[model samples]
Target chain A: MITVRDLAKHYRVHERAPGMANALRSLFHRKYKTVRAVDGVSFEIGAGERVGFLGPNGAGKTTTLKVLSGLLHPTGGEVRVDGHIPQTRERAFLEKITLVMGQKQQLIWDLPPAETFELNRAIYGVSPADFRETISELTTLLELEELVKKPTRELSLGERMKCELAAALVHRPRVLFLDEPTIGLDVSMQVVIRDFIKRYNERWNATLILTSHYMDDVAALCPRVIVIDKGKLSFDGSLTDLVQRIRPEKRVVLRFDRAVSASEVEMFGKVVERTELSATLQVAQDAVREAVSGALARLPVADLTVESPPLEEVMSELFARSRSEREASA
Target chain B: MRRYARLFAVQVRASALLAMQYRVDFVIDGMLSAFSAGVALIPLFVVFTHRTSIEGWTFGEALVVTGWFTLLQGVLEGAINPSLTTVVDHIRKGTLDFVLLKPADAQFMVSTARFLPWRAMSIVTALGIFVLAFVRLGRLPSLTGVLLSLAMLVAAIALLYSLWILTVSAAFYVVKIDNLTFLFGSIFDFARWPSSLFRGVVGFVFTFILPLALMTTYPAEALLGRLRLSTFLGSLVAAVGFVTFARLVWKSSIRRYTSASS
Candidate 1:
């Protein structure tokens, strides 16, 4: 559904010193550096597949999304969405796609979300019947019954985001480019948004690409993850594959009947977290059975469960590794 | 075209709902519009008392020109002006992404997305003043004169709207210019007085370069049956030229846009 070939978006950013004299000098003769926001990154997204675009700050995830959605013209290479060049922004191409930025909004501020929804309906040329059915479905799914009528400024962030999602989906776009869609929301609200996004993708077979700081959102919605750092593709595969490649270990979490010392748990493997009643240890995946049996036999393990390392740690370690590798190569 | 019309209708409805929410603001805006119009007319009244006409225009003819200026100002403040700073805000804040993503003409969406309905009150006041001037003159315009005047009025609006688009599109490059509309407002103020009031290069600039004099003065002249055919054709050509130039500038600006994300 989307093909990006050696895409690059370079920005000529003005550089200046902090002092007033430098600022004044910049007014006459400015210095600029070309920051490659997205440099020669290539990826293909199949229809109905959900993909997570992962990166640290300044990693070009949002830049790629903007290019795909026709908001920004790519500085080099080519991009096609649903068989149309995005930068041209042909009406047919735009009608099949939607870009939702969590920080920004399309809702008319003083008016209700319903008004913006209707406006989109007109702009997209959606029939009244389809518009009504879509709005009804979205309202029910997003639980926006009372929220849609109130002015957007009166709603909470979560409520407004729910409305934003509804407004974006009023046309039932086939490709969804969500940039930080769950930013700044509480845990449950984030889960709600994540679940709603998944359901929409499943129902419409939409090509979904999401970039989010919240790892949980990515985990819940995207099965395949693409990681980028410093405008270069670092990793692209399943979430499980990413975790396994980065950490190559499992977490052995144990609960005790009584208080236990940290030293006792350290014998099994590397201690990740330790407390009086509960502890977690990082053990090699190959040694998981031996480690669990050792803990069960020696320690008073009331309950024990084995799981993979937390995704956040895995991602952090992956980024740290990438940064060091880049430094080494330089 | 039908789709754009329908979308514009929705924008109007949305703007109207927003206006309804600020009822007190509507009242305040009405009062301010009336007060400004009254204050503007004071200078004209003072000048008329001192002399029967300024240059070759009679007191009634000058009032007609002021009425047309106020009417155009109302249309501008109601629709076009509301989008000026908004375009800058959208560019700076990254909200323009939503506009570009829409399956419509971005320029049309940006131009029509905002309006202040209460500002239309000035148009009504201007009409009242125009009718009063016509009654005082005690002569109705010829049919041809009225037709030519209406055409010129439309051409003037097109020229003004095109100029505004040009100004606002510059925001894409110079994003920090928050009050770019102030420049237009200053230039538009020149439309209140007749072009003949200025002489030499200044008159030439207002008449042909900025075309501020053409906006109101030609329409007034057409209504008074004093407009030359050459001037009428020149105003039409200027309107078309400005609109085409503005559209080209807007397209190039969009192509040059880097968006706010990077």
Candidate 2:
């Protein structure tokens, strides 16, 4: 549904020193440096697939999303969504896509979200029947019952976000570019948003591309993960594959009725964390079964669960490795 | 075109609801606008009291010019200024991404997204003043005069909107500047006077370059039976040319937009 070929978005950013002399000198003659926001990145997302775009700060994930959604014209290369060039911003291309920024809103402040939704309906030329049905479905799923009637400023962050999503989806876009759609929400609210996004993708077979600082959101919604660093593509594959490639160990979390020694926990594998009532061990995936059985038989355990290392750790390690690799090549 | 009209209708309704939410402010705004319109006429009143005419224009004719100025000011404050200012804010805060994603003309959407319906009071008062001036003059405009005046008035509005679009488009490059309308406001102040009051290079620039003179003065001249066809056609050409230029600027400036990251 989406194809990006050698995409690059370079910004000519003005630079100046901090002191008064430099500041005044910059007024006469300014210096500019080219910052490649999105450099030589390429990826494809199939219809109905939910892909998580992951990167550290200043990594160009959001830039890629903006380029794909027609918000920003890429400095070089090409991007097409649903067979239309994004930068052209043709009506048909825009009708098939929506970009929902968590920090910024489309909702008219001091007015009900319903008004913005109606405005979108008219702009997109959605039929009344389809508009009604879509709003009903979204309101029910996002639990935006009375929230849509109240002024947007009066709603809580999570409530406003639900309405924002509803407003974006009024036209039933086939491609959803969600940039941090769950930011600043509590855990349960994040889950609600994540679930709604997944359901939307399933119901419409929409292409979903999400960039989130919250790894849990990415884990819950996106099966495939694309990692970028410094405007370059570093990794692209399934979430499990990413984890296995970066951190090839499983975590055995054991709940004990009483205190346990650190050494006892280390007997199964490397002790990741330990407390009086519980312990965590990072075991190689190949030894997870044996480690679990050994811990259950020998350790003072009440219950246990084995899982992969947290995505945060794996991502950090991956980024660190990529940075060092770049430095070595340079 | 119908879709744009419908979308604008929705925007007007939404903006009206927002205005109603602040009813006291709406009333105060109307009173202030009326008072400003009255104050704007003081200079013309003084000039007329000293002499029955300035530059061969009777006091009644001068009143019509001020009336057109007030009406244009009302429209600018009520619709154009607010919308263009909001575009600046959108660029600074990076909310323009939502606008670009919509399946509509971005320029049209930005230009009509926000309006103060209460500002219509200025237009009404200006019309009342115009009618009162016509009564004082003891003559109704000829049919051709009225038609020509209406055409010039519309062309004036088009010119002003294009100028605003061009000014606001600068936000894409100079993102830190907050008030892009200051230059327009200053030039619009000069527009309150008849273009004939100024001569030589100043008059030429106002009439030809910025076209602020054509906006209010030419329409008033057309209504008072003083407009020449060549001058009327020139204003129309300027209007069309400004609109085209503004669209080109908007198209090019949007390419420089770097949306805020998530």
Candidate 3:
């Protein structure tokens, strides 16, 4: 439902030096530098697909989302969302998409979230019946019964986020661009938001593009992951594929019946972590079975488990590799 | 359009709730405005009380001008200023993305996102002052005069709204600036007096270029049984042109938007 080709968003940012002299000099003759916020990046998201956009800060994931949603005009690119040019911001294009930013809000601060929902209903020109039905569904799913009536300021961060989601979904947008939708929420609230979002996508077949720092959010909702770094597409594929490509070693976590020496744990493979009763060994994916069998026979009898490396470590390693590649290319 | 109206209506309701949240501040703002109005009128009332008229306009005639502007500006501030100035804050705070994503015109949303219900008191005060001035004038406005005045005032409001849009559109380009609207506010101060009171070049500029006079002078002049067809038609034409020009500028500014953060 979204196509981006050679997308780039360059900004002529005003450059200022520290100290009084530079600040005063800037008034007469200012300096500027071209900051490539979103360099040449290309990706496509199919309709009814939930994709996680992963990147470090300043990696242009949010910029890409904003460009797709028409909040920002890309400096150079061809972007089409649901067959409409996003920058043109056609009314029909807007009706099909919603961008929810966690740090910012659409709710009317002094008024109840219901008011914003009503305002959106009117602006989107949703029929009364549809508005009622959609809001009811959202309320039931979000458990927003008590929060919608309270002013936005009075609600806690988690409560306000639930209401924010409800407000954004009042029109039943076909494309949902969620930028850090669960950033500040606690663990349980984050799970609630993630589940609610996944359910919404499944039920409505909405095109969901989520950018978040929380790895669990991505792991839970998005089967396909697109990784961008330094305004470039570093990786784009399945989450498992990314993990395997970055870190081919599987983690063999073990528990022991009796205390064991570090040297004994190291005998299994590369001991990632070792303690008296339990130890974690890093083994190649091809050697995972061998490692498990070896540990079962050689180690003190206990429970053992095998799993892939954490998403966070895989991503960091991938980014480090990308930078080193750039350095080598340069 | 119903959508814009609905959006603004919610803002009005929201502002009412906001005012209730800070009732003491609302009372203080009202009292301050009333005091300022009384103070500004004292000199004019004193000078004209002893003499029958000033510069061929009677005390009551001038009071009508003052009262009309006070009312019109009260409405403008209550409805327009709060929301209008917020465009700058939204830009600085990076909160404008919400408005841009809405299906409605971004210009309309930014122009009406805020409604200061406390400023409603300005409407009441202005109306009271206008009625009192009309009572003092001792001459009921003719049918034609009333029609001309109403038409001119509506045109004035349109002119003000268009000007505001043109000014606040700068936020898209100069995102860090927080107080660009102050310049527009200062320039609009000239609207307090009738256009004829100023001399040749200044008067012409006010009537045509900036159209500050169109905001109040023309309306006040029309109500004083001095409606001029040329000036009225000129103000109407300018209002239409300004609205169109404002829309074009807004479109271009939106085109220039580069999202704040990656």
Candidate 4:
């Protein structure tokens, strides 16, 4: 549904030193440095596919989303969303997509979210019947029937975010660009949002590209992920593939009936974490069974489970690797 | 045209809902608009109490100018200022992305984003002033005069909206223009008097540079049945010119929208 080819957005930012004299002098004679927010990143998302956009801070994830949503004009390269040039911001293109920013809101503060939703209905020119159906479905799914009637300012952050999502979806957009949609929510709220997103994608066959700091969101909702680092596409594959490429090790956890000696745990595999009651072992994919059997035979194990390395660790490892590779190339 | 009219109606309804959201604020705002309209006439009362006329326009005739000023002030604060101020806030906070994402004209969206419904009290007050002015003159406005004055009101509203748009557009580049808006408000205060009261540089600037004459004085002259057809046509031309220029500036500036980091 979305195609981006070598999309680059560069910004010329003014520079200055910290001192008063330098600040004064810099005003008279300014220097600008071009920072490539997104440089030559190309990716395509198919219909009804859910893709996670992964990046560290300032990794151009948001910039890429903005360009895709047609908020920011790409400095170079071509971008089309569902067949229309995004920068042109044609009405049909806009009617087909929505971008939800967790940090920023579209809700009218003083008015109830219902008012904002109604306003969006008018702006998008949604048919009255369709508008009614969308709002009823969204309110039921989001559990926002009560919240919509309250002023937006009075709603909690998570509640406001739910309303924000509902507001963005009033038109039933076909392609969704979600930029950190669960940034500041609690764990349960995060789960609710992720579940709602997954349901929306499934029910409507909508294409979704989500960027979130919360990895569980990616794990739960997006089966495939596109990792971007330093405005470059570092990895693009399924979640399992990304985990395998970065970590390639399974973590085996053993809960001990009694306190276990560290030496006994070390013989099985690399101990990622250890405590008096349990130890986590990082074993290669091929050695996971052997390690589990050995740990059961040798260690005081009451319970055991094999799981992949945490998404956070895998992502950090991938970013660190990408940074080092750039340094090596330089 | 129909789509825009529908959008406008919805926006106005939203504003009305917002105004009534805080019940006490609604009543207070209504009373305050009426109170401020009364307060706006004090200077006119003061100046006229001392002289029968200034700049060859009688006290009653000048009241027409003040009435238009009050009405335009209502237009400014109620319809124009609130939305443009929100546009400024949207730019600063980077929430304009939501506005631009909508399947509508961004200019129309921003222009109609907000309104203070209570400020309509000033329009009512302006009507009352016009009636009072005509009563003091011992005659009613002719049909042609009323028709011409209504046309002038449209041009005045266009000019005011266009000027405010230009002012708010500066915020896109500079990031803040609170002082500029303040200066605009203070300068707009001069429109309450006849545009000819100040001659030389000030008069030239008001008539041509800033077009304060086009905003209020010519409209007042139209109401008084004294405005020349040529001057009325000139103001209409100026109104169209300013609106087109403002739209172009707004569009180009939107391209420069390196929207703040989300």
- What ranking emerges by lDDT with the best candidate at the front? 4, 1, 2, 3
DockQ score for model 4, please? 0.68
Instruction: Pick the DockQ winner.
Output: 1
- CAPRI-style quality class for the chain A–B interface of candidate 4: medium
First chain TM-score for all predictions: 0.97, 0.96, 0.98, 0.98
After aligning candidate 2 to the native by TM-score, how far in Å is the CA of A66 from where it should be? 0.6
Per-prediction TM-score, chain B alone: 0.96, 0.95, 0.89, 0.97
| Docking level for model 2 | medium
Tens digits of lDDT, candidate 2, A1-330: 999999998888789989999999999999999899889998888999999999998999988988898877788897888899897889899899999989999899998999889999999999999999999999899988899899899999999999999999999999999999999999999999999999999989999999999999999999999999999999999999999999999999999988887877888998888887898889999999999999889987899898889999999999999999999999
> For model 2, what is the alpha-carbon lDDT of residue A168?
94
Assess each prediction's global lDDT (C-alpha) against the native: 0.89, 0.89, 0.84, 0.91
Tens digit per residue, CA lDDT, model 1, B1-262: 7777888888888878888899999899888988887776888898999899888988899988898889899889988888666878898887887888888888898898779988888888898888888888998878898899999989999999999999888888788775677877987987888889988999989988899878889999998889999999999999999999999999888777745455
What are the per-model numbers of colliding residue pairs? 0, 0, 0, 0
TM-score of each: 0.97, 0.95, 0.93, 0.97
Model 4, span A1-330: residue lDDT tens: 788999988888889889999999998999999898899998888999999999999999999998898888888999988899987888999999999999999999998999999999999999999999999999999999899999999999999999999999999999999999999899999999999999999999999999999999999999999999999999999999999889998999899999998998998899889999999999999998899888888877899999999999999999999999999999
In terms of lDDT, model 3 sits at 0.84
Give the per-residue lDDT digits (tens) of candidate 2, residues B1-262: 7777888898888788889988998999889998998899988888878798888778888888889999999999999988888899898788888888888888998998789887888998899889988998999988888899999989999999998898888878777555557767987898888888889999889878888788888899899888999999988888999999999999878866643232
DockQ of candidate 3 compared with the true complex: 0.63
lDDT of 3 by residue, B1-262 (tens): 7667776776666667777878898898788777766665676677876998766777777777777777766767878888877888777777777887777877877777777666667667767777777888877778888899899888878888888787777777776545667777777766666557777888778767887777776787887778779888888898889989989998877666544443
